[model samples]
Target: MANEHYAKFIEEAFVKPIRSVLIIDDDYPTLDEMLELEIIHKNGDLPPKSDKRWHDNPGRIKSVIDGFRQPQRPLLVDIHDGANVDTKGDAKVAAHLHQSDLLVLDYELDKNRPQDGARSIEILRGLITNDHFNLVVIHTSEDLDMVYREVILGLLGATSDELTEGEQEAVNQLIVEYEDVDENALQALRAAVATDQYLHARLHASTYMRTMGQGQQPYSDFCALADEAGWDNGNRRLVLRKLLADAERPLRARMRNASTAGLKWATSGVRWVKAESVFIAFSSKADHDDLFADLQNALEAWNPAPSRLFMAKLRAEMDEYGVVAQTEALERQHALAHWYARLLRSKGDERRWLIAESVLRHSDQLLNTILRRVEVFATELISSEAVAAGDNIEARCQEHFNVDLSKAAPKKKAEREHNAFVSSKSPQGWHLTTGHVFTMNSEHWICLSPACDLVPGQGATRNADFGDRTPFMAVKLHPVPVDGNHDVNSNLYIFVTLDGEVQKFCFNSQGKEAVSPVWRTLYAERRGLLDKDFGFKISAMGAGSRKLVATIHPAQVVAQLRYEYALNLLQKLGVSMTRIGLDFV
Candidate 1:
């Protein structure tokens, strides 16, 4: 009744070891079967640790997480299932989606009531753009030939195949149990996965990191793939670094095994690897100098440059490779000590401080290095403020780390040299703001260069005054017939607000208005009768004394005014505000 055989495979292959899984399908039967299996097997009792799957073999789990290094996971959500997904259920679905590394969505629903496909995609797209992590997988069970000919090749851009014997059984069970299947469901699922960019990004990242162990070249290849895919963001880069670091975590465990076997592996000869119960291996104990050299060489070759951390790691490898050379070993020991000292003196997270302290406890000669690093941090605290606050170096120093310059001994002539060094290293004119800020409402804008006049609408009033009649009114303007290519001044937009709440607001660099091109495009594409759209509305005030509440139309000045204000705020914050445009329907 439980497909008793699957119970063993499920338990051994998934449930017992893997605590979490993403189940995806449009068929209620398939979903029921999975859920039943989970319930019957008590698999749901597994810990919901999204961060790691410890039940998996350490090596395997590492591979999986490494594969998922890209920010997002594939999420399988059955939006058509009014039971699991509905307008009201979207929030719940989204919450669940946020917890997963990937997304799986069922395109079809059993009701034949037809959920809006575009709307579903819109919701997912919105979340994907906002999150920038998570992979997506779409599942479908249409006829192989038809699917191959139509949806896969034409609509979804996926390759199709006949179901395998086991898959056939699953699909049969699904169809028999849930007789109501819609044709568009699978298409919707395929389109959702194929067209969305988040899925593409996640999949590429996961696949690349997953292949890190095959060789150094594969890891390099992955980095190239990332650059090509436009996933060159900070988090994506962090994944590459983490993958390398994690490669070190398990070396201790492996070394113990190698050491016990009397293997000549460099990892084992040194105490770099650890045993389950004890530190059986020592970094100095490893005897396989040749293996260590080769391994370190390979690792260095694989790691890209321009990273200070990577350089340090490379140096560590070189030291390991030259462990037999006493002179080189001494140099390396000193370098490592110096490195630890630098870490100790840095600012930011206290964990680095602790790590440095631990390293220092092992080597006292590192004291000088530590002191130097502290001076570097202190100098930074001073110099950065100096640049940002305009030569008030003391005030700058006080602002950054809350150091009291008033209490410190006056600077000596030599201190000027250190200041010069600090200035050289400090990023050009970039300074962290001290709490004390001086704001002045000058008649002239900050950029007083001759080209300042070229800055769009430089002196335009911040308020959107839509006549005096609508006092205390506010307005939000969006593109009219909102589905089209957006030209800020060309496309008309509707504004909504109380009609007269005026405030000075800033506009983004585009200077056209606050509306974004993408928003306008979507709005224009979906423009139709107001009553037909879920988000569109226009109404007059209620009760005996009636007045217009808000109107939807092109050329809405209120929307532009509000948008301008928001844009100004974003500019002040130094965040790019041009990503998404405004569109009104």
Candidate 2:
């Protein structure tokens, strides 16, 4: 028999509901069905039932949900058999539960049982640990303070208020906002404001940085869970808020985890790609006849410059000056600030890589004149930048805040060569060489011409390794831009930069798309800005493109290309010169 139904959707309109609400109670439709079947005794009441968890009046509760129904959005409902636990609380939530925009979970699964809200908390903690919580409403008749105490201890580890002054203030603000007088869906958001810091720490320590799942390489994304999350407009907002700071608080406790995740997001993928590329190259080498060519390819694939050793040194030297500042690269501003902040952090971290010697040079002056103390020690100065170890919850967890940084900005190229380049620490004689690259205006340019040609009024085979007042012939390299019209591998001559960007000549000289090529002249101690559009030169001679750059300075050399690849590039230059059959008079 068809039961009577209420109007929940418009038949004519095409647009469906935007959000889905799932209400999980102790008992609902099951109890409603029993009442419908006239299972009551003489006085319109059901006899003592076997199930101790059933609601006293489920029909009235169902009516409350029906009252919230609208034709504009979808709604879901479920009933728990029984639930109560201080520690061991588990809920068999379906994958589809991920689709919920607002989860209305009952605080007490069974009123007759203990007020162990762990069942709801367990469900919430799981979703949160995996970053899958929206607006959850713990609807109950009990006082809000009771639930606050339970949730704070369960998730936020309210073990001690050992927070810094600023952190204490931030936490207080978080508490006030969530403790809203109106018992609405957003009230239960306190659990999210101060997310499971321990869970995130564990995720980073045990799972990401250590060994778990793919072992910190690939993205820690729950693609299946995301797919299960509905693709509706409302669901997009739910996912949006996870990253956005409008409804969220910046977590000091989880800074380490955030940084690890960011680094993995940046470096890990490229590392994996390079490893795979090396494997493919090695595999091809076994089948190919040109062992050297295959080996060169494998070597290039295995180690793309700016070398790993350089990064290690850079990190090592930087560590000596300052400790790693654990700040959330993803906090506040628009939804995009998190990503932009991370990119800035990657570059801005160089600021911490200072010259300790510069400060130490004035140590005696500081101790006598500048220091009011009898003797000012280096440890006291170093203490200014020291990071708190363990989960101490210091006041400086996040200090810079929204204020502008008054200090001078970090430079792209460190004035001291050894500060930025690992190779610079080697012999000075090897600084200037063929195929050496110079970084300028945030772009990389390699010396494509021979050392003999770079020297002015030079012999056919002048090999001084490096000469003074010489114009080094060079060309800019850029990552291949895909336009679907030209093949990505337009030319065989390829290059890689210090930041691991795969690059090719600015001009694609492989045939149809080949353009006229030109080279810029670079010289030592010759300071001049490059042409506005140096990459798109239509002639060999250009304004502001030529300068007598004799020897490549230590500060300028970012990396050196392999001999084979450099030779191939030189060969391409010969081919590019003959690209035009004839010239106009």
* TM-score leader: 2
Clashes of each: 60, 9
What TM-score does candidate 1 reach?
0.20
Off-target runs (Cα >4 Å) in candidate 1 are 1-24, 28-82, 114-119, 122-132, 139-439, 443-585
Candidate 2 Cα lDDT to native: 0.38
* Tens digits of per-residue lDDT for model 1, 169-199: 5444432332334444323322322322221
- Model 2 Cα displacement at 326 (Å)? 44
What is candidate 2's lDDT per residue for 152-256, written digit by digit as tens? 334442122144566545544433443444343233333322333233333244443232123222223322222333234333223323322322244333122
lDDT of 1 at 488: 27
Query: What is the Cα-based TM-score of model 2?
Result: 0.28
Q: After TM-score superposition, what is the CA distance of residue 129 in candidate 1 from its true location, in Å? A: 8.2
Every model's TM-score: 0.20, 0.28
